[model samples]
Target: MSKIVMFDMDGTLLDLSFDDFIWNECLPERHAKIHQLPLSESKEKLYQFYQSHRHTLVWYSSTYWTKTVGVDVLKLQQEFQSKIQARSGCIELLQQLKEQGYICWLVTNADRASLRLKLDNIAIEHFFDVIISSEQVGYAKEDINFWQELQRLHPFNPDETIFIDDTATVLKTAEKFGIQHLFNISQPSSLKDIKQHQDLEFKTLDRLTELLSILNEIDRKDNDVKIA
Candidate 1:
């Protein structure tokens, strides 16, 4: 039987430093400039908004943010499109998965516009068998309905699936939905400190290619069980 691997786009397959720059630095500066407020004040206000909408669909929507924050968030991201980059060993892992005949899916909470922007900059789209945005599902990945909708759209055995994401909340949702193998990224952003595995709910991978060895080990264990 073939196994399916589901990956969160940003912070999993891609270096999240670009997103960190856009949200934490660029957006606040732009917001402050537009509102003629102090940078500190703007950051505090935006941080409050972020906290309120963190795992919601609106939180991931560029249009919603553009209107609420009075800045064109999508346009801002495009301005720094050059900074968008895949994580180290990202392509190598995808290529190996494709060659090895494992089905690959990109499951991201990024709204359609943001998803398009990232795909336009990175050349990893062709590697995925299916690419889904939470916007299309009408629910954020933190919501169980997103998984239900995803399964409805493209049927796959939950027990045969592996999910990798950087967010603990998203991983917990997937776990609740019964995906068998759940993994987290230790260092999602090149700009941030590495997350300790003890802090994460699932196994944390420091390198993208480490997944290949993990998959091999899982296969080995399954074969041993079958032979026994």
Candidate 2:
């Protein structure tokens, strides 16, 4: 069987500016109005709240944030749908992966409604063979148990699977769980510059052809070992 390649949606395959706009600007503005607080104050308070729950399940839960911040997040997502876009070369990379024998999956922390909205807005839903959300598994990617449960429900060879993501925290968690091939996206959003990381990292999907070469080399090495 061909190797499976899993991707993180927001930053790995899609541009992350829409999410940044919603969290930093759109939601904060509405939150200030609802509470009669100054825009600056609301933004600071929300940032603190986000910091407190950085890697937890609540951090990614739209339902939790909707009730906590008193704003309709999905509605705001729709309003800012125009900002949804694919990262440069991401669509072409997906096309190339399809042409090859690899399987593609979308593994994200985004809620189902949010995922559907973004997919519709970007029109890239057909590229994935499977879509799994943290909401469905009841654990965030930062949690080691999340990876364990993911393996149970959707079996894939850890040695043959390649996971790419933008978040350093979640990538570390996946690494701890014994996943062999891990790649980090240093620049998930165009607004951000490339970040330095100790692990295998790339600034854009344009280097994915290089990754194919690496995987092919690994397969050849494994085949030679088996023959010996």
* Residue 57 displacement (Å), model 2: 1.2
Best by TM-score: 1
Instruction: Note the Cα lDDT for every prediction shown.
Output: 0.96, 0.83
The numbered model that scores best in lDDT is 1
For model 2, the stretches where C-alpha displacement exceeds 4 angstroms are 197-210
lDDT of 1 by residue, 25-125 (tens): 99999999999999999999999999999999999999999999999999999999999999999999999999999999999999999999999989999
lDDT of 2 by residue, 1-228 (tens): 878889999988888878998999899999999999999999999999999988888888788899989998888889889889888878877788878878999999998889888888776678788899899998999999989999999998888788888887888898889888888776788887766554444322334455667667778887999999
Stretches of candidate 1 off by over 4 Å are none
Q: Which TM-score value belongs to model 2? A: 0.92
